[model samples]
Target chain A: MMDRRRGLGRYGLSLLRFWSVSLAAQMEYQLNLIIEVVASIATLAGGLFTLSLFYAHGQRLGGWSWEEALVVLGLSTFLDGFSSTLLRPNLGELVKQVQNGSLDFVLLKPIDSQFWVSLRNWSPWGMPEMALGFGLVLVGLVRSGARPGPGGVLAALLLWACGVAILYSLWFILAATSIWFVKVWNATEVLRSLVGVGRYPISAYPPALRLLFTAVVPIAFLTNVPAEALLGRTTPFWCAASAGLALVALICSRLLWRMALRHYTSASS
Target chain B: MNHQRSPAPEPTTRPLQRIPMRRSPLRIARTLLVSQYALMVEFRAEIVLWALSGVMPLLMYAVWSGAPAGAAAGVNPQQFARYFLAALVARQFTVVWVIYAFEEDNLLGRLSPLLLQPLPLAWRYWAAHLAEQATRLPLVAAMVLLFVAAVPAAAPPLDPMRLLLALLALHLGFCLNFLMQYAITMLCFWNERVSALERLQAIPQLFLSGLLAPLELFPEPLRAVALHTPFPAIIYLPAQLAAGGPIAIGPAFLNLFGWLALLLPLNLLLWRAGVRRYAALGA
Candidate 1:
């Protein structure tokens, strides 16, 4: 147990180092860094502005009030920010690496290749979005008057983690397919468009579309469930289901990644 | 005859410019269109996927039509549905992706070769986009059909004259949108990161261009701003016309044509300046 704990600590240190390296590299281009930060903030603000426009005309969209909708929007932006910052810069490039056989370097690393590929690049540019999104979520909760107790807050945190897991797993499956499909580069785009659906509360959609969001794509768990938790609307059953989904997704993605590695005949070969 | 017998001059990049001279502009465009069509057909599934990416209006439709307070905004379910469905189709024609193509070319130093051609670089983008739009028309029609079948009440009675006008407006809108994006993309010559610059324009375009809601539904102050801007001429005018909404046909056509005329010259000026800057940088 001691040895295992030491190893885990070492791994954590290396991951921290990786993130610092990315930050250092980004800071080298000060103009690009500034622009990225500004653009991210603008994007988040633009989203909120659109929501304000909608609410300017009506008190409630579907059944949710503007504050509740803001919560969903904030959560979605946060997850999307996380994806763009960490998940996208890394996994989005997996297809090109596979095509060029540069993935060999990743596979040869002593560290877990999946972890390396997924978390290697950390964009400080997305920091503004991350900060804004968290802020919006707080403001939304306050404005919406949902005073969740400790248990509810904890549950929301857990479900939010599960949502991140699901999103990461979905991206993993897409990246793994790059081993077989040469032109699946746009797969991430498909993921992006689907995620855009989560910008609103799931209840806002028609019955057919809502079913598709929750069951087929499960994007509702990514934003809606967490927002719902904050609003004291989440049932115990949803919390368990979300946790279960995340575990299953992560495991399946691990299996898929391993299988894909086996099929990666190096471009040099 | 004697010139042919003379020893050939030293091969230079100048020769490349003349090689493209052998093909007429029309012939070159035809070939480019053919290849682009083939590419679009090859990526039919991807094309459909891209078409589905137009989710903004769909989301707007859901909000404006489903909400109880939507009627207060002068948008009943039928009007909201009709407006968004038409906007979706119009957007299929008016959307431009030249920013991505230009950015990639400039970053990879591949733009220099494109500039070497005798014809303007915009022709290549125009051909590709036109071919993609032409090829995707059938799919768009099918989508409109699917939407109409699903919501019969939203399908307004066909007004032949209005639709013809709308199609004309949409075609001009396509040209206007393409030229505007091309002009914006020309900034890549000076800026290293144009995507951020693009978002500055894109955010406004999203809000003001009727992608979120019809211009009439916007707050009164914003509605006035949108009406004056060229952004709405591309989407709101054509969509409103298609939905058979109360739009003065004479002024709408004039607005579209006026924007097109203004953009064409502006694009040409930007292209010339951008190319000069690009060459100065040895790119």
Candidate 2:
């Protein structure tokens, strides 16, 4: 037990060091911070404008009220920001490491390769978007008159955690494929574009696409399910299913990474 | 022969300044197209992934078709599908990556070598974009056929004249987009990271360019304002024309030319200033 505790403590300390170094390096470009803030604001405003178009003329998309849909949009925006902060920086580095055989040094380290590779980089540019997304969610809850109790809030947080796990697993899985297809850099772009559809409630899509997003991509869990939880409208079944899917996805990503390493002959070998 | 003789006579203590032979514009264009196309074909796999990333409009169609707004706006599901499919094609053809390319080359100091060539650097990027569009054609055609096969009712009857006109609008739209982005790319001479500015430009392009939903669905004031911007001329007008939707051809062409007239001079000015600035910075 003491050994396990030390291991956990070491990982925590390593994460802190990793993020601080990257933050310092990134802070050299002060203008980038302002650009990121403005770009995120513009993006959120444009998203709100598009969302408002659906609600114009007294229409609800797939039976989702305006405020309810706002929650989904907020969640989507938050996930996008999260991706920009964590998933993109680390996974992009992973692809580079694979191309140049720097991953060999990573494997030689005393820590878990997956954990080190996945959590080694963080960008502060996504902070404003994340805050704005949380603000929107609160506004949506107040406007929609859905006051979640303590238990409801806990459930919502848990489901959101599940959503983040699933999202990370999905990205890591795709990034792992770079080990085989070294030039599959743009594959992540395709995934990002597909995830853009999650801005609306799953029901807003046609039945066919609804099924595809839910089953094939699990985008429904990424935004809709968590939004439903926030609104105090989620069922126990969905909560359980979301947790299950998140677990399955996380496991799959781990297994795939392990399998991919076996195939990694190192660059120019 | 006159040029050769003059150059031979100038062989003195100083090195001769050879005046390049005047080549036909057509020949120059053909050579640029062929060489760039060959380069593009080598990266066909990455190009295919890039083509698939343009599935935004198609996804929007799936939502809009089922939404009540389509019915309220007097556009049925079939029209939504047709419009978005055409939008997908329009966006595929008009996509510009000049800013990304230019920023990279400028920062890596590759632009100095490119500028040393006799050809204007803009034509190289333009030829590359045209070649990429050519590479994308077969893949986009396959996607369209698959969509039409899945939903036959979404297929509109092809009008020969409108088709020709839509082709013209599409190419003009590509030129306008290229110029606008190339203009933005010139800022790389001053800023190391101009892609952030390009991201800002893309926000308006996304909301206003009829990529998310048809511009017809936007409220009156917004739609009118959007039409005035250069965004709609890039996607909305050409897509609407190709989809057989009602649009005034003359006014649409006028809009394209108007923007072209404004941007062409702006690009030329920026190019001259940027190159001078670049030289100073490099020195």
Candidate 3:
């Protein structure tokens, strides 16, 4: 029992040190950090602008009202902010490392390669996006004209946690693909399109599309499903379904990740 | 004189004539395409990824069309129809495939092989892109036509003559885009992180190039800026022509030609200066 605790302590401390180094790298560039912040804000504004264009004519889009759609769009933007801030920079850099045959050095280290690769570069620039996302959620709460009651906010957080999980799984799967297909930047653009689709009310799509959202892409969980919970439009079934889907996707993604590592071709080739 | 130099020369013995009747330009282009195809075959998965990435415009179009049935913000549902289909076609047509070309050229420093050839390096690059067009054209056309068939109301008139003009405009637009990217890519000769520059430059092409929505849909100052910018004449102008608008064919081409002529010279100069700097520093 004493040995187990000592091992756990070392693991926790190394993780903290890794995160600190990642944060240091991210904060090194003052100007790039500012540009990243502005770009995220611009992206959010672009989403709102598109939403406003729809609202200019009617009270609703397809079947969604202004408040509900706002929540959805806001949630989508917030989710996207996290995706870019956390996942994108590291993955983009990893692609470069793979292409240059530098990934072997990374694997030689004692730490878990995936854990180090994914968590190695925490962008201090991401702080602004996190803050902005939180701010947007608050604005969305106000815009929905309903004080986000504790239960609803709790539900939103739970759903959001699931949403972020879905994104992590999605990215891990893509990264896993990189273990076999080293040059994989081309497919990364698809990730952007997937998130872009989440910027508006999913109701604009037909039932077939909704099925696609739920099953194939799980895009609805990433944004609209959670936003629905916040706006009181979510059914109990949706919350339960999203959570289950998130769990399953996460589990499979981890399995795939392990299999990928087992098959990882050291870049020495 | 060379004809006379051959021993046992006969009628029609000139080696140039005996060779295939292919034009020099045709031969150069063919060689470029064949080599490019060979590379593409090696990385077949990347090609599929590129084809799949074009789906972004489709997503944006669907959401924008979700606007209320009537005119919303000066664009009717019908206009939105022409706008998106045109954008799709434009996106497919204007793809310069900077990824493969830049990756190999910069990372490997293998551009010297192409430069040593008689062909202008630019033509070789264009030739590879053209082969991609040849490979994908039939499918892309079918996809666009399928969309047009779905919404006959939004179908652009099949004016063969106007389409001819649109094709010319499209070519010139592609040239301008190529030259613009060529100029910017020279920065790679100096800077190591071309990816960041590529990302920053690419964002505007999607937004400012009218890929997301028609220039007419952009808000006040933005709309005017977009109109005056050369990007719209590339995508939006062709869109007007395709929709059977009485777009003056002459003026559009004139503007396109003017920009092409100017940018072409500038790109050539940049290439010369870039090569000098590249050689001087040996990066």
Candidate 4:
């Protein structure tokens, strides 16, 4: 218990530092950064328009109504956009760092390498995502005419938080694998492509993809199940299940991260 | 004396540029292709990886097409396949690396070297991009041919004239895409991380550009909007030709040529502005 508490604190500090550097980078390019922001806004708007078009064909997809799917798609985009701006760019550097033996510099720091790698930077152009997600939720709530009482709201927030936690944990574990194998760029792609399938509601997937998203990658737990709860369609099983899945994902990723650390032969001797 | 007596009766007519030893265009094309093939050997893995961008949307196509007759979106089952598959093949054929090359040159500070060359910079840039395309085109064409041969029955009837038009249309489509992306990339002179700006546009271009789904499937005003937009012609028009549709070939070419006319000059203006900004910043 003592060891776990210390480890968690260090991880929190690393995440804070990462976001700081990323925000600073965005500030440096203040002018065209506006275009980046607007471009992202245009894209999210276009995505929402696509979903609306589909919904025009039918009142519901599978079982969820238009707004419900919108909530899922909206949150999923927010999460993916968050990762793309903040994480994806950094990740493209991973193979280069390993190949060029630059990981040695990062390894020498007195920090958990996975924590450091994952939170090493923040890119704030993705800020629009949080606004977009919140906006979509508002739209869905207005359309559904169902206000989640405080209890429902609290549960949804907690679930969403846990969902992000699961996403972070999963990426850290996968990224740590680079320490063992340098050619895992495709592996990273496979993981992202796998997660992408989660943009739509998990239920729209056939049973196999559903299993893959939830069990194999557990990304659907990252967005869909939580969005479901907020839309007032969630069950106790979902809350318990996602919370439990979050715990399991965190534990497995942490263990994998540690094992990877023991094997982290710095790119240089 | 022998040259004067027998061979001197016929002196050859002068050719353009009056160069007696210049390489023929066909032979130059072949040499460029050979060199490109050799260079690609080193970057083979990257080419394969770049190729995967065409595959991910196939999954979405599968799911949407699976919907029962009436329940499907605006695209019927066959039209969806035709649109996505055409987009796939067209993408494979028309990819160019000009933007990447431009950004790389900017980053490495090597633009001066190219400017010093006697050749027209734009012609050299265009030539290098084409050299690469020439090598890749054969492989792409061969792949299509093999697939066609596999299913002789399903193969679109060979129409030589229309096929030539489609090839021309595809080349023009690549020219437009390259110019648009090149202009975006040249903005790197102002901001080094212009890839982010390009990426922010990715989601829109991926879906709305008629790659992942047809513009027709989009609801109401959007369907109308996308049809009018220049984005669809880049990938969709050429792809429809591959799937054996009777495209308004002349008008489509006119549309693409218009985009090139608009975008290339605008890009040049942006390059001028971006470079001035870079100089002011002491780059």
Q: Model 3, range B1-283, lDDT digits (tens) per residue?
A: 1133324455774664343434466655667788876765676567666666776656665666665622556666667777677767777777775544765687787866656766567776777777776666766777777877876656776779877877777777777777777777766667644555555556556666767666555668776665656676667677666766434566566666777788788888877887788678764
**A36-152, model 2: which lDDT tens digit per residue?**
999899999999999888888789999999999889999999999999999999998999999988999999988899999999999999888998888899989899999999989
For candidate 4, give the DockQ: 0.21
TM value for model 1:
0.90
lDDT of 4: 0.67
Model 2: runs farther than 4 Å from truth?
A1-5, B1-20
Cα lDDT of model 1 by residue, B163-270, tens digit: 888888888888888888888888888886676677767767777787777777666787776676778888898999989776667766777678778888888888
Model 3 pairs in collision: none
- Candidate 2 residue pairs that clash: none
- Model 1 C-alpha lDDT per residue in residues A35-133, reported as the tens digit of each score: 667777777876887677667756777688998998999999888788878888888788889878888888987788888888888887666777788
Residue range A1-269, candidate 3, lDDT tens digits: 13334555767777788778877875666667757667667656666665665676565787777766777777776776677767877777777777777887988876677776777666666666667767776777787686667887788789989999998888778866877888787767777677777877777765666678778898888888888878766778988998998899889887887897688677775
Best to worst by DockQ, what's the order?
Answer: 2, 1, 3, 4
Rank order (by lDDT, best first): 2, 1, 3, 4
Instruction: Give model 4's docking category.
Output: incorrect
Prediction 3 TM-score vs. true: 0.83
Q: Candidate 4's chain A scores what TM-score? A: 0.86
Clash count, one per candidate: 0, 0, 0, 1
Task: Give the interface RMSD of candidate 2.
Answer: 0.9
**DockQ score, prediction 2:** 0.77
**DockQ preference between candidates 1 and 2, better one:** 2
Candidate No. with top DockQ? 2
- Weakest ten-residue segment in model 2 chain A by summed lDDT: A1-10
